[model samples]
Target: MTSTPPHQSVLDKPFVLDLFAGPGGLDVAGHRLGIPSLGIEWDKQACLTRYAAGLETLHADVSAVRRDSFESLPPEINVLAGGPPCQTYSVAGRGAGRQALEDVKGYIKRLMAGESDAEIDKKLMRLSDPRTALVLEPLRYAIQATRSPNRGHRPYDVIVLEQVPAVEALWERYAEVLQDTGLPDGTKYNVVVDVLKTETYGVPQTRSRAVLIARREGLGDAPSLPDPTHRAYEAKEWNRRNGGIAAAPVTQQTLYDVDAPEPRRRPTEDARLEHWTSMGDALAEPVGIKHRGRKAPFLVRSNYGSSGIPGRRGVRTDRQPATTVTGRISRFVVFEHLGHDVVCEGPRFSMNEAGMLQSFPPDYPWSGTAQAQQVGNAVPPLFGAHLLSAALGLPAPAAEAMREPWVPAAEEQRAKLRSHGCGAADGCTARCPRPV
Candidate 1:
């Protein structure tokens, strides 16, 4: 019989309003760190998943949520966080640049106008209007109304936003609009967390995302991106257990195959071998091309070319960690490859496994179809917890003791550096250091 895993939250004990809160990736992350977070998502299925995981969630359009709606609940909201949809500005879709920002601003402007403002309310009610514009409306409303010196209330202490790298530049506008709302002119609001990832934090899959952390000036410093607890890049003195400045690199092997459940043995070795071989060939050769030598594995499976190879030739793979997981895609069929070659393909990752790769707790219950699982699309819970913790000026949870592969190489290098007496206490040089 299999043993159940222990239960513990990932982030601080409580935060406010998981905006754009699809399937509560942010909420799960906050929970993992012991942080309490409420979620607001339009999708009912997504909200159900959050509710199942013990989160306070609202199934409603975020834009339509009014500051007045929660006025009776509490006077303080610790954090405001979410990743608004990015397809409007994603590379794959139409690059809806500044216009998208304008639409978002318009939404907030509409929300800020009271119901008494019949003209503005009518325009906001237009069904043809883009709802994405309303995504940030509540934030803008809270920002404007909450800033009066004696208003007897405070908005969220910190505003945390996440999106694709392409949206990095838009933060400037986000900051500007936020400031226009109630924040003081000099309010040091807006911190761009450039490097956030599940893989870097030991989630196995390397999912990169940018998180924007902003807070009122007097409320302490803006959230700092958590130091990588686990290294995805190899460094000479980085140790997994030792808490220090130097971090170690995470390996691909550690991310993919580690902690995975045993695969279902096919009826015959020939079948299994053939499956492995085919996947091996795909990994060896870039996707889209047939290899001559190795008999491609016997796995007869359908393949979909999602990420187009540049050359449309030889094997390829993406060196950087993969984009967010859509879930439901077969594992053996490589959606992303190195250049054109498939990497490792065997069985489709289980929902729980994908969630782990995305940094969700092993037992976090996620409701919905594989497409709606939100495993890959959501931010890793660990990374989210760290960011939320930093925003709230709370201490990070103690990291679990785990074996790290890079430790050996790092130790070997550290030993050589120690003899020279040139190594810092942690043996890390700000820039890449070469031993003399």
Candidate 2:
């Protein structure tokens, strides 16, 4: 049995039930807002990390957890947030999404029409791949609770979901289904879909996610989208369509480059936004000022291996934003561009750097095993913080943590952490600017 979290008062506290919760990203945001949260995750490694972080957990898979389980919860659980495993729908993966999604949608429609499991099982073939349909589990909870005779007890006040852009339409379809199938009183939910660019928020990575929000308050309780606090890209005019409340653009720059002059580059189609926090920013330590970017290499290329394997673009820690972090999270093998014989400087960018780029705290208690898989799959906590705030109709606050843990007293304590390379020590020097 899961231990119930201590509640000071149940009258007005916001409770979050996170399904498919990966290392408690949304849960961290909830805690910061004074909300109590519980996560249901299947991976033992990820659950270990969550437990280490002092979060409540039901170490079980959402697909296996029966619908009756939701009714077992105390009334305080008013908000439900989830980001189902996204590998099958990710662009990087061998996306069998076209066939998988159509089949899954057909299964959902049949289930809604009161078809028996045996009947649907016989019709659906890709049951072998579990990731395709885990998404429907959330909708099942909503519809079953909405149809319950207990009118005094509301199913939920709000529901928020985030996933890869490939799964956007499925979630939008879910919003449509919930609105169409109303409660006994005919009161429907207010739902909206927003595709968010993570850099627009504050994380250093240029990743994009599809977000869906549904509110079950009275009709007038429809929540407004969380306004952007920083300008990530240039906008012609300040309008919601151009990615919400725009501020000065925060473009890509490394922690080493923080003291350097601003970047000068030709504008893109949408006009580039502002300087996003860099992976280097998270690695900066208060050692006496270290040697900064000096001309080490004019051009570089990375991800070199077998001839059949396509090369992954090299990244400059000083300026260019990193590509999305994946489950494997390989180090980009750095090479100098002299046009004939390339010199290998060895790859920088450690697992901790990847996690930091994902906006996990430098000291976050990552379960110390399967480090690459754990960080790659986990949502960035800072990004999750903004989304949860937006769903609640309260404006999302700016990132609240300092760049790196700094003690005003002395530089004696080195940031104790694990990484693929010696992180941010004084001796090593490397540079990567955007290739022209």
Candidate 3:
């Protein structure tokens, strides 16, 4: 008799269906928590990475599944999670989605009013970018699963959605509709919507995302956002107002040793939370140099503009959290911070170091082209765990678990790559396995 794997055997009810699931970031969190999940991604490269990571995935466009009203989905799925494409909505890209925000809201009203899909698609195609309409796909799935007779009429117990900060208004619209249109069983959804700082959740990168969570009212108390377990990054105060220059070498003092006077704490400041994690904390072993038996700090210089100022690159000491990891990661340069005003340029961050900063495992099997872009697009698994725990009404994982090293399922493959001294960075021409 053959035995089932641990992840498959533990798959009972409350499965998650993730849409636009690039590289399975949220799915990784679900797997670690013993929850079953399947992701649907249109990108072949992302699908390759997902398969390599042993994640369940449907290699197809989300619109294809929407045509069947999600009839192909597993009946046991009771949770809906998605992070839709944010290119048009992001500040780095053209402001197509941002400009069409009002039109998108109008489309939501149309969806709520029982408009036909053909009619909606026709109107959506006229927008600046048709992909912007995908932001509404989650609502379409939710409506089908809950109200459509063709589907099994199984209502999702919890719904979670996240996107760029520009999508906050859209999520607010989601909250209003989800609450107004209660479940078929007469129980409304209790919803919460807000922008969350990833650094506060122990991600060693400073990034923010808009999040919306809704739970069926009859299940229990209303869902709430997870309390931050780490302090928020205060760059100005921490930098001692040095005009964005490093105050001192990282090896000499702790991250909190600032020369400036202490500023008043914000309302969200909690005495119990720990200090925000820094790049030194996340990439100490891989990126730090050995100096007199102790780890020495480094500097990362951004070629892009700092805070919307063109041509002014940003520099951060390893003692501070890394700036938002973006698709343009090649533009970042690393330098060894030699004491007494000496500096030496070094190799850029390896794939492992970049992923580690984003709270992914150091050994995560990144496959396909543009791996850095995949890492940048993913939700930090550590942050997702806290969000999932809150939405499911489960006890949060221990804070220490965030720092625990993770070994990917495909250890043999990783071992082979390490043997070849291939660090999986750009310009590497290793004969490693690519997705077939």
Instruction: Point out the higher-scoring one by lDDT: 1 or 2.
Output: 2
Candidate number with the higher TM-score (1 or 3): 3
Model 1 C-alpha RMSD vs. true structure (Å) is: 18.9
Pairs clashing within candidate 3: none
Order of candidate numbers by TM-score, starting with the best: 3, 2, 1
TM-score of each model, paired residue for residue: 0.59, 0.71, 0.83
Using lDDT, give the best candidate's number.
Answer: 3
Ranking by lDDT: 3, 2, 1
lDDT, candidate 3, equals 0.73
Q: Model 3, range 236-355, lDDT digits (tens) per residue?
A: 776655434553343323223323343456776797887888887877654222111114466777755566552366677777788998776766877774566656776788766777
lDDT values for all models? 0.47, 0.58, 0.73
Residue 31, model 2: Cα distance from true site in angstroms: 1.7
Report the C-alpha lDDT of model 1 over 76-192, residue by residue, as the tens digit. Answer: 455677887766655545655434665555554454443233454565555343543454554554554354343354555677787766666556556665555534322335454
